[model samples]
Target chain A: MATASKAAADSRANLPFVYRQYSAEQLREVLHKMYLIRRFEEGAEESYMRGLIHGTMHLSIGQEASAMGICMPLAEDDQITSTHRGHGHCIAKGAEVKRMFAEFFGKTTGYCKGRGGSMHIADVAKGNLGANGIVGGGIPIAVGAALSSKMMKTGKVVVSFFGDGANNEGAFHEALNMAAVWKLPVIFVCENNGYGMSTSTARSTAVKNIADRAAAYSMPGVIVNGNIFSEVAEASHKAVERARNGEGPTLIESKTYRHRGHSKSDRNRYRTKEEIEDWMSNRDPITLFESELREFGFIDDRGIEAIREAVAKEIADGIEFAKASPSPDVSETGNYVYTEQA
Target chain B: MDAMVRELSYAQAIQEAMAIAMDMDERVFLMGEDIGVYGGAFQVTGDLVDRYGADRVLDTPISELGGAGVAVGAAVTGMRPIFEFQFSDFATLAMEQIVNQAAKMRFMLGGEVSVPVVMRFPAGSGTGAAAQHSQSLEAWLGHVPGLKVIQPATPYDAKGMLLAAVADPDPVMIFEHKLLYKAKGPVPEGYYTVPIGKADIRREGRDLTIVATSIMVQKALDAAATLEAEGIDVEVVDLRTIRPMDKQTVIDSVKKTSRLMCVYEAVKTLGIGAEVSAMIAESEAFDYLDAPIVRLGGAETPIPYNPELEKATVPQVPDIIAAARDLVKGVR
Candidate 1:
C-alpha cells in the first residue's frame, strides 16, 4: 500500500501542470478549443479564397496553442487586448465563431454590427477588448484597463498580446514601466512569431529575446515553447497568479510561428519555403496538443475524430450564418459616430 | 447658474470643478505631468493632490503618447479620466491615441463603447514661450468627428463646461489659454453644467458680426467697444464649441448685422476663421453680406520668441478693431 501511494504521487508529478490540475473532461475541452482555432482559420482561408469575404484577414493558423494556453488560466471576467493577428485570441476569449464570421462578412448581426471588420473584432461582454490594428497600440490601453481594475477594486487581471515587433515600439516600454510602478494586475504576453510583416526580429529587435526587455521594467521575463500547449499554459499560469496576488505585472514571451504570411497581400519572398514546411511538419501546435492528449489517455482516436467533425460542422454553420446575415444599411453609415442623444 | 456667485480665476474654477467631479463620482480622476505635488506646469491643478491624494490626481511620467493612451483605455473601461497636456503643442506627440483611439473607438466598435475622457490643453501664444510651447492646435482635434472641442472664454464657462465634460457620455476636449488662467470672472458654486455645442453672444449690435473663439473673444469684445466709438456697431459672438459649431447663432448674427468678421488666435489660413467664412458663404446668410467677409487671425508665420513678434503673430484688440471697422464701412 505504501509503494502504491508513492507511485501515484510520482505519476502526478510527471504529468503536465494542467494535466495534474484539471480533470480529464477539462483537458479534453482544451484540446477541443485548440482544434476549433485551427479549423476556424482554415475555414476562413478557404472562404477568403472563394471570394465570400472581402478585405484582408490576418490568419493565426500556426499560433493556436499560444492563444489557448495564455487564456487557459483566465476567468470569464478577466480582460485582454488583442492584436491584428487576433482571430485565435478572439476565439479563446469566448467569442462565438458565427459572430466572428459575420463580422468578416460585414453583416449587421456581427459582433461590431459590421462597423469593425477583421482587425477590430471584439466581445466586450467576455472581457475581450477589441483587437487593435496598430502595432503596440493596445499595450497602453491594457495598462489602463489594469489601472481601472486596481482602482475600482474589481480584482480582474488584464492581458496584452502583441507581436515581437511591438517590443521596439515606445508604447510597450512606457506601458510596462507604468504597470510595474503602479503594481497593477496585468500580464504582457508577447507572441513573438519571429517577424513583424517582412522584418525579422534579428533585423528589427535590439534584444536577443523579447522577454529580455522585461527586466528593464523590473518584471519577470518568462519564455516558453508556444507550440507546446503544456509549456505555454504553465508559463501563463504563473504569470496570471503573479498578477492576481498584487505582485505587479509579468511579461511572457510565447515563441511561436505563423504558417501564413502577415496578410493576404504578402508575396512569400522574405522567408524560404523550406523553413515554413519545417514548422508545419514538425511543430504544428494542434498536432502536438492532440498527441499529448492521446498519450495522457484524456482522448482516444474516436474522441479526436469526433472533435474534428464537430469543429467542421461549427465552421460550416458559422459560414452559413454569415452568408445569410444582412448588410447594414448605407444610410445608417453616420450612426454610432456618437452615442445617439435621447 | 446659481444665485450665490463669487469671483474666481479661470484656473481656480477649473480646479474647483475637478474637485467637485471627484467628490461626485469615485471613478473620476486626474492624470498629467506635475499635476500632483508640483501643482502642474501652469498651476491649474494646484493643491488638489493634498485634498484627493496622489492616486486620484496621478502625476504620470513625461510620456504624452502613453499617458494619453492609458487615459483612453481607462475611460473605455469605466473610468472617467481627465488628461492634461502641459502645453497644447505637446498634443502633436499624442495625436495617435487622441485621434485614432479615443476619437474612433466608439465608432469602430459599433457604438459598443464610449470613451468618457476629458483632455485639457493650455493653448495660445504669449508669455514668450516661443513657437514650440505656444500654439492654438484646437483645429487639429476639432477636425475629428467623434471628439467634442470647446474653448470656454470665462471662469464660469470653464468650470461649468468642465463639469459638463465629466458628465458627458463621449470624449470632450477643453482648450484653455495659458494667459486666461489668471483671468477672473464670476463663477457659481456647486453642481452646474454649461451646455456644449452652443455659442454665446457676448455683445449685440447691428452694423457687423464679429465671431471669435478662445482668447480671441475677449479681443473681439474689446475691439467692439473701440468700434462702437467709431459708429461701427460691431456684434461679438463667442464661438464656445468648435466641432458641432453653433452655426445658427453665427448665421443669425451675420444676417442681422449684414457683415461678418472672424477673429481667432491660430494661423490665419485654414484656421477657425476659414471654416466660419466657408460656413457663412454656404448658408442662407450669404446673401445678407453687405461687404466682403473679413478674417482677423494670426499672421502666416510661427509664433516668434520676440515679444513684439509674438504680439504680431496672433490677432489683438487693435487688429480686431481695424478689421471690424473695415467690414462695417463696406471696405474690403
Candidate 2:
C-alpha cells in the first residue's frame, strides 16, 4: 500500500500543472468549455452572415485555449476585465451563451438587457466587470477593482485582458505603475495576437514583447505559448497565486494568433493566406488542447464527439432562445441612464 | 434644519464633510494628486491622511485619465471614491474616463452597475494661475445625462452638498470655485445633506431675478445689496445644481419678478446662462418678460495670468450690479 501511494504521488508530480491541480472531471469540463467558446463564435459568425446581427464583431477563433486556461484558475467571484475581442473570455468566465446570443439579438433577456450588445456585454454576478470598447480602458479599472479588494479586504484578485495594441496606450503604463506602486492584487494579461487592428506590434510597440514593459512597473514579466493550454494555464496559476498572496501584479503576454481578421470589417490585406492557414492547421488552440486531453487519457474519441454534439446543441438552443426573446421598449430608452429612484 | 451652526470657510466645510463621510462609511475614501500630507493644491483635504491613513486617503500619481478611471472602477464595484482634480482644467486630461466611462457606465451596463463616484473640481478664474489652471468647465460635464453636476456657493451648501454627493448612487461632480475656499459662512455641525437639483433663493425681490451659480451667486447678492439703495429690488436665485437644474424655481421667480438675467462666470456663449435663457423662453415665464434677458458671464477669452486681466475675464460684483440695473430700469 505504501509503494502504491508513492507511485501515484510520483505520477501526479510528472503531470502538467493543470493535471496536478484539477480533477479528471474538471479537465474534461475545461475541454467542453473550449469547444463551447469555439462553436459559439462560429455560430455568431453564421448569424452575422445571415444579417441577424448588426455592427461588427471582434472574433477570437484561434485563441480558445488562452481564454479557458486563464480562467481555469479563477473562482466564480474572481473578476476579469476583457477587451473588444472578448466573447471567448466571457464564455470561459461562466457566462451563458444563450444570454450572450440574446444580447446580440437586442433582447431584454440578454445579460445587458439589450443595452450593451456585443462590446459592452457583462455578467456582473459572475464577476465579469464588462468588456470595454476602448483599448486599454479596462486596465485602470482592473487596478481600481484590485484597490477595492485590498481596501475592503475582499481578497478578490482581478485579471485585465487586453490585446497587443493596448501596450502602446498611456493608460496601460499608468495602470501598471499605479498597480505596482500600491502592490495591488491584479494580473495584466496581454494576448499578443500579432496585431492590433491592421498594425503589427513590431510596427507599433517600442518593446519586443509586451511583458518586457512590466519590468518598468516592478512586477514579474511572463511569456507563454498561448496556443498551448498547459503553458498558458501554468503561467496563469502562478500569477493568480502570487496575487492572492498579496505579492502584487504580474504581466503575462500570451503569444497567440487569431484565425480571423481583427473585426468583420477587416479586409485581410495585412497578412498572407499561407500564414493564416498554417496557424489554423498546426497551431489552433482548440485542436492542440483536445489532442493533449486525448493523449493524457482525460477524454477519448467518444467523449470528444459527445462534447462536440452537446456544444452544437447549446449553440442551436441559444440562437433559438435569442430569436424568441423580446426586445426592449423604445419608450424605456431613457431608463438605466441613472439609478432608478426607489 | 439643526441649530448647531458654526462659522466655517468653504475649504474647511468641505474638509469637515470628508471626515464626516469617512466616519460614516468604511468604503468612503479620497484619491487625488496632493491630497495627503501635501494637503492638496487648494488645501481642501487638509491632514485627513493622518486620521484615515494613506490607505483610505490615497495620493495618486499625476495620471489624470488613469486615476479617474480607477475611481470609476472602484465606485462601480463597492468603494465610494472621491477623486479631486488638482485644477478643473486638468479635467480635460481625464475627460475620456469621466465622460465616457463614469457618466455612461451605468447606462451602458443596463443598470447592472452604478458608479457611485464623486469628483471635485476647483473651478473658475481669479487665482492668477493662467489659462490652464483656471477654467469654468462645469457646463461641459453638466451636458452629460447620467452625471449630476452641482456648484455649491457658500460654506453651508459646500458641506451639505458634498455629503449629499457621497451618499448619491450615481456620479456626482462638485465644481467648487477656487476663490470660495476662504469665503466663510454658517455651517451646521455633524452629518447633513443639501438635496441636489434644488435652487436656493438667496434674497427675494420683485423687479428683476438674477439667476446665478457658484461664485456668481455671492456676487449677485452683493449687487442686490448695492441695488437695494438704488431701489432696483433685485432677486438673487442661486442656481445650485446645473444638470437637473431647478427649472421650476427659475420659472416661478421669473413669473413673479417679470424680468430674467442669467449670471454665471463661464463663457457668455453656450454656458449655463444660455440654458437658463432658453429654459425661460420655452417655459410659461416667456410672456412675463417685461424686458430682454441679459447674460452676465466671463469674457470670450482664456483666463490671463495678470490679476486685473483675470478679474476682467469673469463677471465681478460691479458687472452684476450694472447688468441688473440695466435690466430693471428698462435698458438693454
Top candidate by lDDT: 2
| Highest DockQ against the true fold, candidate | 2
**CA lDDT of B83 in candidate 2?**
98
* Cα RMSD to the true fold for all candidates: 2.6, 2.2
Task: Considering the two chains of model 1, state its CAPRI-style docking category.
Answer: high
What TM-score should be assigned to candidate 2?
0.98
Per-residue lDDT for B221 in model 1?
87
**How high is the TM-score of chain A in each model?**
0.96, 0.97
Give lDDT tens digits, candidate 1, residues A1-342.
Answer: 011244544576778877776666777887888888888888888898999888899999899999999998899999999999999999999999999999988999888999999999999999998999889999999999999999999999999999998899888998999999999999999999989999999999888999999899999999999999889988988998999999999999999999999999999899999999999999999999899888877789999899889998999999999999999999999998887878
Itemize residue pairs with steric clashes in candidate 2.
Answer: none
> How close is chain B to the truth by TM-score, in each candidate?
0.99, 0.99
lDDT of 2 by residue, B1-332 (tens): 66588999999999999999999999999999999999999999999999999988999999999999899889988999999999999999988888888988888778999999999999988878999989999999999999999999999999999999999999999999999999999999999899999999999999999999999998899999999999989889999999889999999999999999998999999999999999999999999999999998889998899998888888889888887888788777
DockQ of each: 0.82, 0.85
Q: For residue B85, what is the lDDT in candidate 2?
A: 95
